[model samples]
Target: MGESSWAIDLEKQITTAEVDEEEIKRWVIDLEKNMEEEEMKTSRSIFKVPTQTTLLHKNAYEPNIVSFGPYHYGKSHLQLMETHKKKAVDYFLKNYGKPLNNYVKALEEVDQELRDSYENLDDEWKHREKFLKLMMFDGCFMLKILYEYKETLAKPGSENHDHFNFDPQLCLYIRRDMLMIENQLPLLGLVTLAAVQTGKSTVLFVLSFCYFLKLESNSKNSPYSNYINSTVFAEHTGVLNLPILIMDEITEISFLNLMAFERKAKGMGSAVSSFLAFMGSLINSEEDARFLRSKGIIQSTLGNDKAIVDCIKLLGKDMYFNPHSEMCLTQYRLNQYYLNSIKSWNKRLRDWSSNFMQTYVKNPWTLISLMVAGFVLSLTVTQTYYSIHKPK
Candidate 1:
């Protein structure tokens, strides 16, 4: 009777173990299904700086003077810019003749989409009203900067009354900060504001903004100047007709963040990504930096040539790139240039033996003189050999 009772107890324990295993399997399956559903939804475009990039150059990724998005929004050092941003917003509304409420309402409508653009925003920023205000203020400020820049360009040397232009260095730093990867507002915000204010498209606004970033024509000092001069600008507009060839002065942080955002939001084949990869390929050394400088492809007030090279290297550190993406004809041309340079060097090496001889024997008189000298040396050597063996 004791043996029978023990067997029954063991069987009940085994049954419970089986039930637990089945429950665990069901839980795992549900977890995977939920993960798949989440992936199907749109992912965030703005990201915290990746560990690899940040570890190399933390200062490059951090905002120094002004912060644009929620990532660095409330920093004590950046608070000074808040007042300027508010003023810019006021100016934007006044110029567009739209009430602040209208802009706020527009932002509210796309609030969810805007939130989706940024990864891991703070809980306080999660509130709809707060998020809308953030977007309204930030977006308007960016639009205002672009507007003022356009005006300045349109009417140069005409009593620069813009507050940002009061101190050129401060303005430059702010512009640089705006380009930082962590210091970005959604392009959607800018687009919405532009559409509401003017009947123009986002492309025009982007082009104008980039222009304000000072992407001038390729300087004669740029290594790419010859290539640019040889080809028609209209033929190779890259992936989006962006003026990527003249990105010499853009800050490292700005370029990296822009490319990161483009990659996340627009996918792998954006013109911005392609241009970055192309620049990365070109900038491997100081010589490369010098070449770029010669072509006016790079212009920096960051001291010297080494600084520029270091900056480019840091910008490209651990960058995400797909080699097979569509970069228009730019990638193909760059590859061909690299291959041709190698082939040319090989040809020079192959002709090196002939070149050496030609160096000393270029003219007919020089060739005859060398031949005579060689014949005399050979005759003297033969005579010496005979003397040494003359039955000594």
Candidate 2:
């Protein structure tokens, strides 16, 4: 058929075709219902890592030694920790002198909300008994681990203390696994278990051993920056200061998962994401990484400067930045400072003045020489003035 004729025929057929109104309406209704359900799922804090991000670095987001919540629960590798979890439960009950059933009942009361906190929970975990059991076991295990971690911190000499039969390597693996986004249980479950066991909140228990790297802030509470002049006064300095980042295997894994979680969860600002983006901007080469290390800004045990740069590049992959975020604003300010010629010149002048003062005036001998020269110059000028008036 000719191209014009074929197009006309197709248009005619589509226009003349009978439409099914009822079926169309049913399809529309179904779509709306499904969309509403998906919208409701946004409240869920736990989620499978997006495929695009996972493709970049899959292992960073997956649990290794253990799984905490429904996302990675019951996987073959993670199943090895089940026996340990049970042992933790035993230790928890004996240490607190509480019946196991009481803790189970406590989690049972909030089980529905707990289930809703996770996205796309499996049918096996949907069973009330199984879900409550998981919560009780995992919560107790986490509490026990926290107690041990706290003790380990309190007494550095007790590293050999075999708590829950966990060796140092196993404990390290557990820490990395727990930091994964998909491997997090709802704090509600842990808090409920704590209240039932200790008759109080779980703030101390839950927050134990959870440390945060403090980012230095600027005048507007944004990320801290450096200025042209290192010795500039605090009030006049335009510095964006960042926290000293210690990059190793565990730190890399933890930050990757944290950035993923911050991306998945709503209303949580992209602080980590922004920080990674800023770091990526700074460290594009081994030389850049080495310079940062020399300044004590980046302490990397990740082998070499090249490895640090590569690690940062990996972290920055598929990451998003919120332009309105404080870190982004800080970056914008830095770019402005770089691009503004007037500001650059002003900073150069300040730096030159400060350097001049430090080099020439601040030294006792140099200051004395300048003072003696000035005094001699003044005396010679006075003598010349008298000589000129006397001659006249």
User: Which structure among the candidates has the greatest lDDT?
Assistant: 2
Model 2 agreement with the true structure over 138-181: per-residue lDDT tens digits: 88888778777677778887865456777768877888888787
Candidate 1 minimal-lDDT segment of 10 residues: 233-242
Kindly report which residue stretches of model 1 are placed more than 4 angstroms away from their true locations once superposed: 1-43, 93-95, 160-165, 198-204, 212-250, 262-266, 269-303, 319-392
**lDDT (CA) for every model shown?**
0.69, 0.76
lDDT of 2 at 317: 77
Task: Estimate the TM-score of every prediction.
Answer: 0.64, 0.71
The positional error of residue 25 in candidate 1, measured at the CA in angstroms, is 16
Q: Kindly list the per-residue Cα lDDT of model 1 for residues 27-69, writing each as its tens digit.
A: 9999999996576446566778667656766677788888888
Backbone N/Cα/C clashes per model? 10, 5
Candidate 2 wrongly placed segments (more than 4 Å)? 1-42, 204-209, 212-238, 341-392
